[model samples]
Target: MIGEGVAVRIIPCLDVRGGRVVKGVKFRDHVDMGDILERAAAYRDQGADELVFYDITASPEGRSVDVAWVERVAEAIDIPFTVAGGIRDVARARAVLHAGADKISVNSPALARPDLVAELADAFGSQCVVIGIDSIRENGRYRLRANTGDPDNMTDPDLDTRAWVERVQALGAGEIVLNCMDADGVRSGYDIDQLADVRGICDVPLIASGGAGTPEHFLDVFRRADVDGALAATVFHSGQIEIPDLKRWLGEQGVRTRTGSVAS
Candidate 1:
């Protein structure tokens, strides 16, 4: 599934908080990293397949995504970019797309109103709608967690990750980004079992996010799990793993990836 011109993407994430890129451990205690536009351009030049700008505090703050920032980032980078956080309805999604984002991702809002997923897909096409699932493992099962809370304390027993993935896909999500709440920023590795669970059931492009510490972690997930792409912030942001170097390594190991120009 990897070789033979099939490209696995390496996406650099910009977790924006207060209009700046930040990194947090397990979605808490975030520290400012740097300017968003600067980081976006740098990643684009560094050969990132795509850029994902997540307003880390938008949904919690209950506000619309920053269209102006999206416009600026789009202008600075040549690769496809995605904007998520605080996008609740068709109008907001449209605004983000109009601002030059290639896609709009929704997390908490999609859970609150699943219909909005279909609505956005209908208006902007399914390719434009990305369903971001933030999941935490609990009681030996993966549970959905939106906004913020302790993983042990938070658990939606009724809606497991697999069920939600199928539901969102059926609801019109063109892509699924599975973010591991437990592994987020842990730098250990991705939740392989959980990702495999969703991957086995999901047909759309699946992006595995969270716990990317070493390049081997990326290789492991792509090899062990049925994921199309892998996303990481701290590793890329802190210069721990260079995109070109990572791609080269993957290519050397027979893993196909877009090392030049974004794959789209």
Candidate 2:
């Protein structure tokens, strides 16, 4: 199911802070947009397969995940949602799950212990855990970035991506979210080639984040990256592209997406 014409996913990401739905410009520009409920409801109605809620500044200094906000958003969205921000351990992960999130994305915490992935898998199902990776092309080479990668730890060189994949998989992570920090918002498109390279080495589902400017950008990712899902933040938040329109566009471009509405 991983290819250009497969049932490619069009996922909208909501960057949150202080319990408010905010949109950032390239992982650095922070601006509040509206209440979480409205934006999430909009994405769900727009026909997104799923939505991502990221607490943009959850981990500058080992901060804890925002539980109340997660709970609120989980209660608000109809489609499955992932809450990630300062998820560093099993306890925090459990809290996120209990708050109603279908999935929890892990970053710095996984890098630190590596075993947290397995621990979370044992506690929650493997499907509940997604490993978020931030990659950058330096001197024509893509390397991992340690800060919440892709507007995600949000850190430094942590060995190679291949090694990280092996360890995280052994630890029982169910999916890998390859986010190119370098491509965060140039809007050119996703680093499908980069994600494809990561996919070639990993068996888990790969969610390609960063660098989505247009519907064509999404098509390029699905066609070239062989990813399970494509996540975008700004276009969705800034009102450049609507979710239903994007999904319909994907369908027109020969990408598979569920045909239904929030009210349906």
Candidate 3:
């Protein structure tokens, strides 16, 4: 169960490819959404608790996130935000943070070199480091995959999902964002069973990503898995769900969310 009185954060995720916000089913066949800065500012004004910006191609292309946009986003929104993709070392992480991100998320690079997690945590504090895990269920057990679960780049690290969660925490990760590959952009609902398994082992904040289709889905994850936050991309980007309305509805269901004025 989630700690009592812990307010659940509602976050909107922006997956950037070629500097445009994009959404894809199962992390492929992405379609452009809109300009990044416009979307970021809109979500902030909509009362989003936080925002997540992912440069989806950075790792696959062997480059770091463009810090120019990071600086622009920081100047655009008042809410805290996280930047992920291709952040492999302390220097790259520092550049992202210095550009105004409240947190830096590491996925593929951390999988390649696990020590990078401790290195960033040592230099910037654990609270500034977030580990993004892309996972899929295979043979009734969870497995970790690298490269944002892109099929061509998919390589099983041969690490159990639960065990990896424990390892990252030991390495000083302050939070974990678990992206269920099977559930990514499917919109049926969050992977409750997967999330519950992680919550059982994760001591730090756990943000549930992938498979958020409706406001009810958010309610279900918070009520069932006890995650610290629920993150959605397609729903928010496609106007299927709005943050203020979602937060208001969740609060009505007895989920403690940070109160904000709902757009009339």
TM-score: which candidate is best?
A: 3
Query: TM-score order of candidates, best first?
Result: 3, 1, 2
* C-alpha TM-scores of all predictions: 0.92, 0.91, 0.95
Worst 10 residues of 1 by lDDT: 148-157
Instruction: Tell me the spans in candidate 1 whose CA falls farther than 4 Å from its real position.
Output: 1-3, 149-157, 261-264
Tens-digit lDDT track of model 2 for 28-87? 667889998888887777777888887767766568767887778777777788887788
Local accuracy of candidate 1 as per-residue lDDT tens digits, 1-264: 434766888998888877788877655788888899888888888888898998877886778777888888878778898999899999888889998999999988888888999999999999998999988888998888876523333435357888899999998999999999788878999988889888899999999998999999999999999699999988898898999999989988878877665435
Backbone Cα, N, C clashes tallied per candidate:
0, 9, 0
Q: Model 1 lDDT vs. the true structure?
A: 0.86
The true-versus-predicted C-alpha distance at residue 111 of model 2, in Å, is 1.2
Best by lDDT: 3
Q: How accurate is candidate 3 locally (lDDT)?
A: 0.90
**lDDT to native, each model:** 0.86, 0.80, 0.90
The RMSD (Cα, Å) of candidate 2 is: 2.9
TM-score of 1: 0.92
